[model samples]
Target chain A: MNRSILLQSRPVGMPGPENFEFREGSVQEPQEGQAVIRTLYLSVDPYMRGRMSDAKSYVEPFKLNEVISGGIVGEVVESKSGDLQPGDKVIGMLGWRLYNTVDAGSVRKLDPSIAPLSAYLSVLGLTGLTAYFGLLDIGKPKAGETVVVSGAAGSVGMFVGQIAKIQGTRVVGIAGTDEKCEYLTRELGFDAAVNYKADNFQEELAAACPNGVDVYFDNVGGSVSDAVMNLLNDYARIPLCGAISSYNSTEDVGPRILSKLIKTRSMIKGFVLSDYASRQAEGMQQLGQWLAEGKLKYEETIVEGFDHVVDAFLQLFQGTNLGKMLVKVSDPQA
Target chain B: MNRSILLQSRPVGMPGPENFEFREGSVQEPQEGQAVIRTLYLSVDPYMRGRMSDAKSYVEPFKLNEVISGGIVGEVVESKSGDLQPGDKVIGMLGWRLYNTVDAGSVRKLDPSIAPLSAYLSVLGLTGLTAYFGLLDIGKPKAGETVVVSGAAGSVGMFVGQIAKIQGTRVVGIAGTDEKCEYLTRELGFDAAVNYKADNFQEELAAACPNGVDVYFDNVGGSVSDAVMNLLNDYARIPLCGAISSYNSTEDVGPRILSKLIKTRSMIKGFVLSDYASRQAEGMQQLGQWLAEGKLKYEETIVEGFDHVVDAFLQLFQGTNLGKMLVKVSDPQA
Candidate 1:
């Protein structure tokens, strides 16, 4: 039986367990040149929240009563195609189901020895690619310059700060909790980490970035972004990633400080992962090298079981997870 | 005697007559390597408003009880330097007064035969150079792309539209009045024009830009900018020149739809002319050629008396000026 999570309803302000429905169904037998895969892991991201609303966006909204689909890593249990075998580990844009009978070309095989299989959804994958292209292409951090990242402990933010650090920048991180702030400064070697939840978030941030912000990789928006924007130096570059702060808000968010952009002669650019599809290879090659050299490190907050997929996604908004948030669907056939 | 205007007080919200105090003073005789010039024309620009406030900005704030300075075209009245002679026309950063004893190297001689003396303060000068670099370097409008210029009938906007037209792109202009809109499409050769002050501004703009905006030259900010931002196409580029709309506002202007930048992969870059100072020669060369070819056109709202200089400067915020707003201080030698 294939257990799949369906978009039972559209969320109004914030999405919850009620917005999704779990369905049990039989898996289809693979046709010629087809493969059946058992889910191994599911990657939840902040961008997926954008896909839940029926608004004008880059990607289409998830239809009501239909299966929710996202980045998934799985193992092939049945294969008719000669290119893939029954025991190969694969990753693709697959359904959040126990089993999937996909076209052989829909999934690509991953070797476990090349970092962990989960890294395909993380450091060497979409999250890593987002950080690489956004920072290098837009942010363009220089050595000795101060680089600030909002949502510093999130999947994309963690990578953005590290990449800027690797470029020899003074990285100041902004996160929600004290532990996340500590992890960023103590473990990740960030120049400084300010807790956004702290009463003196703005003052702490200002003190941390005494030289003023040169490159700001924004993963969270609203007032937090506005506060960071106030400290931007002349010719600062802002790479707009995700406005996680206002995604699920029922009320109107306040105005962004746009005059700052003009006053400082700065630049703010917004882009998605798909925008750099052609340049993925260029990004992956560099990210892979950094991982092999032990120059980059990552942490994942894994929520066990397929039933908890919805909870894992909600955890993103709640700020319960640090680094990449994933649901371990199943263990591979060792 | 030199007539001067001093910033008597920093404006609380919108500046009025009281903020300026008129004064009369005597000029010193020219020293060696010095030249005294009679002010011919004074260029009043939107950016001047920024300098009036004591905020953290690229340029310094206007000091109390000192003559306000800006672009001035003049005739050399007394010269102790060989480079400048009496009756020679020149332009440079000069005081808002009848006479200025400036360093000989500070003022560059202008040939009236190439362009009218005031043209050095408008089309063939900083205004023209601003349009050239901002449109070509940052906006980068390609042929067949739809380029839109806000403040379309102003000095810089008129040149921006014309330059985009020369590039074979469809040009659309946005202004405050019907006359300005008509001038943009008729005299400036813009493909379409919309009056932002109209009751159905959004509808008018939507109709004018049917192809979606590919390049946006933003001079006016606030709600007007937000309306235009919504119509941006994929990979659109915005050259943010000025924010005249919100300069006088005491309260918060509405938020910029920054997510639009991300969804469409657009970029908004703010720049001051000094940032392109090194490339001024390149810009002027192109603008001069365009002017010589009769391909570029400009209009001037000339305030005849030095007493009305304050009125002319105030007209900028009121949207009364059609093109370059200049106060004619004196006439070039006839």
Candidate 2:
């Protein structure tokens, strides 16, 4: 038996559990050039909120009453392809189900020796690559320049801060909790971390970057972004990655920033990981090198069981997860 | 006696006549390497509003009780330098006074035979160069793409629309009045023109750009910009030149556009003409060629007399100028 989560209905503002449905069905046998993989881990991201809507975006919207799909890591249970065999660990954009019977070509085989299989779904996957291209290619932080990252406790933001630090920049982070703020400075070695939920957020953010912001990696856009915008230096570059703050709000109104941008002669560019698809290998190799050298570190909050997938996804909006948020469906055979 | 206007006080919101004070004084004698220039035409621009307030910006704020300086075309009345002679036409960033005695190198000599002295302060000058760089460098409007420019009847906007047309792109103009709209489409060769003040502005804008906006040259950045932003195509480029709509308003608030930008993977860059100083000659040469070829045309709403400089500058906010606004201080010696 296979249990799969489906988009029950479209969300209006903030999505709730009622918008999703879990259906049980019989597992299918693998066809030629196909592999039946048992799900190990499935990644949930803030950007996924955009996919739930029917609007035209970078990625296609998920169909109603159909199986919802995202980044999933699995172990091959049965294989009809010559390349994939039982016990082989692979990762692909597969459905949220206990068993995913997909074409062997669709999934990339992962070696557990280099790093744990779960790491591929987090630090070494789209999340880390998002941070890599957005920060280096767009933000282009120079040494001794100030780099500010919003959602600095999240997966992409964490990597952005670390990579900026590696580039010899003064890294300032904006998060929601004091605990996350401490973790960013103490664990991630961010030069400064300010809690956005604090009453004195504006004052704290201004104080964090004494030299003014040269590069701003925006994940959560709103008043938080407005504050950072005021501190932009001449020729500042902003890589607009995600607007998690406005994801659930129907009316995302704020102070117009074009005047401020003109005053500083700055640039703000929006991008996604797919924009750098041709440079995937380059990003992965660099991120892996950084991980091996102890220059980069990552954390993941894994929820147990496929039944808790929706709960895990919902928790992302609440800012409960420290880093990458994933759900463990089953353990790989030893 | 030389007449000059001084910044009497900084404006709180919209500037009034009381903010300026006119005074009379004797003209200074020319020193070594200096030439006394009789002011012919002085430019009144929207960007001057920013200088009126004591805000730290790309240009310094106007000093209280000091002469407000800007782009001025004048005639040399007396010279102490071999480079300049009496009756030679020149242009420079000079004080708003009848006679300015300054260093010869401070002003660039202009030949009246090449083009009218007043043209040097309009089409063949900074206004035209601003449109050239902002449209080509940042906007990057390609042939067959749709280019939309706000404030399309203004000095820079007129050049922008015409240049986009020259690039073989479909040009759309957004302006305040129907007369301006007609002038843009009929007189300036714009493919389409929509009055932003019309009741069904959004509908009209959508109808105007069937292919969607590929390049948006934003000059008025408030609700009018919000309308155009919704019609952006993938990889759209926005060259933010000004925010005239919000220039006087204390709170420049509107819908947040980072989410829309992310959906299209677009870029919005705020730039001043000075950013492309190295390529000034190239821009000027191209503009001159276009004007010579009759592909580009310009208009100046010259308010005669130095006393009306304040009124002319204030009229910019009212959207009264058809193109560049200039104060005709005195006619060049025939």
Candidate 3:
């Protein structure tokens, strides 16, 4: 039986599990030029929060009573074209479904030996490409410069700090907890990490970036960004990837930024990963090398089951997960 | 004797003429590499408001009780260096003074036959270069795109619209009065013009930009900007040239922008003209050719005499000037 989760209703502020509804139906056979893929994992991302609202955005809003969709990895159980055979693994923007028989054109087949199946869903996928381009192309961190990243323990932020460190920059991280902070500094080789939830966050962040910030990779916006923006050096470059802090908040937030940009002669650019698709292969090659060399490390906060995919997605707004959050929905058949 | 304007006190809100104090001093003789020059024209700009305050900015605040300084056109009356001679026209950052002996290297000599002497202070100067780079480099308005300019009757905004029109784009100008709007469309050949002060400003602006705004050259940054911002197209580019609307306001005012930028995948870049010094020669060459060919037209509202410079500077906040506002310190020669 195919179990799926649908967007039961549009969310008001922070979405709850009740906004999602579950359905079960038997799997169907593949048509010509198609494959039946069994779901292996579902990636939960912060940007998905934007899709819940009906407002115009880069992507369309999820229709009520329809299946919620995003990046997914699965193993093909059957195939109907020369391009694929049974037992091949694939990844696509398939959905929160236990089984999907879709067009072969929609899914890219992945080799298990190249990397783990979930790595294709994490460091080697959207978040990894996001960090690589946003830092190197937009942020352009120079050696001996300071690079501050908010949400430094999340999927994208973690790679941003690590990549800046690789470029020989002094990295300062802002996270929600001391645990994430510790992991950033001790395990990830970051120069310093400060917990934004603490009373002394602003002071600590200032002290950590003594030379002022030259490159700021913003994953979470709001007051934390306002404080960080104060320390921007002349010609600072800000790669605004996401604003998870105010994503679920109904009220408008963020300080006056145009004046700051003018005064510091700095620049802030907003970008989505797909905008860099033409250059994605170059980014993936470098990330793959780093992962293989042990220079890049990643962690997954996993919740096991198709029944818990909605809960995992809800946890993104709560800042409850560390690193990449994923739902291991029925791992490839043993 | 030299007449000068001094900063009496830093302003609290909107600056008044009382904040300025007049002074009389003697002109010093030319030193080794210095030449004595008489101020011919003083360029009064809205950005001067920022330099009046003791707060941090791209340029240092006017030192209390010191000669207020900015872009000035002068005639060298004596020679000390081989580069400049008596009666030579030059432009430099001198002061609100009638006479001055300055380093010859500090000024760039201008040919009156190439363009008028005061034109050196207007279309062939900083405002011209600002419009060139800000629109061509930053805005990157493609052919058939809709280009919108706020403060459309001002020095820089006029050139921005004309340049976009030359690029085969539909140009829309936002000005303060019906006269300016009529001048922009009928005289300057803009596709459309909308008065920002109209009762139905937002509706008028929307109707004017039928295809939506692709490049917004913003000079005003308050409610007028917020209304314009809502009509941004996908991948829109905003060349943030000025914020004259909120420059004198005691409080911060503007819509939240990070979300807007993300929604449109747009970019806003704040830049000073000098930041493009490496490309200035290229811009100057183009602007010079345009002026010589009668492809670009410029208007100047000149307030005669050194004593009225402060009043002319104050008039910027009132939006009284049509194009470049200049204070004629003296005739080039009597």
Candidate 3 residue runs with Cα over 4 Å from true position: none
* Stretches > 4 Å off in candidate 2: none
Which candidate ranks first by TM-score, i.e. highest?
A: 2
Candidate 2 residue B111 Cα shift, in angstroms, is: 2.3
Model 3 misses residue A181 by how many Å?
1.7
Cα lDDT listed for each candidate = 0.89, 0.94, 0.88
Better of 2 and 3 by TM-score: 2
TM-score order of candidates, top first = 2, 1, 3
**Which lDDT tens digits does candidate 1 get at residues A47-84?**
88988998767888889899999999999998999988
- Clash totals for all models, in order? 0, 0, 0
Interface RMSD of each: 1.9, 0.8, 1.9
lDDT of 2 by residue, B124-175 (tens): 8888999999999999999999999999999999999999999999999999
Q: For model 2, what is the error of residue B33's alpha carbon versus the real structure, in angstroms, after optimal superposition?
A: 0.3
Candidate 1 DockQ vs. native: 0.62
lDDT of 2 by residue, A48-129 (tens): 8999999888999999999999999999999999999899999999999999999999999999999988899888998999
Report the lDDT of model 2 for residue B72. Answer: 98
The true-versus-predicted C-alpha distance at residue B9 of model 1, in Å, is 2.1
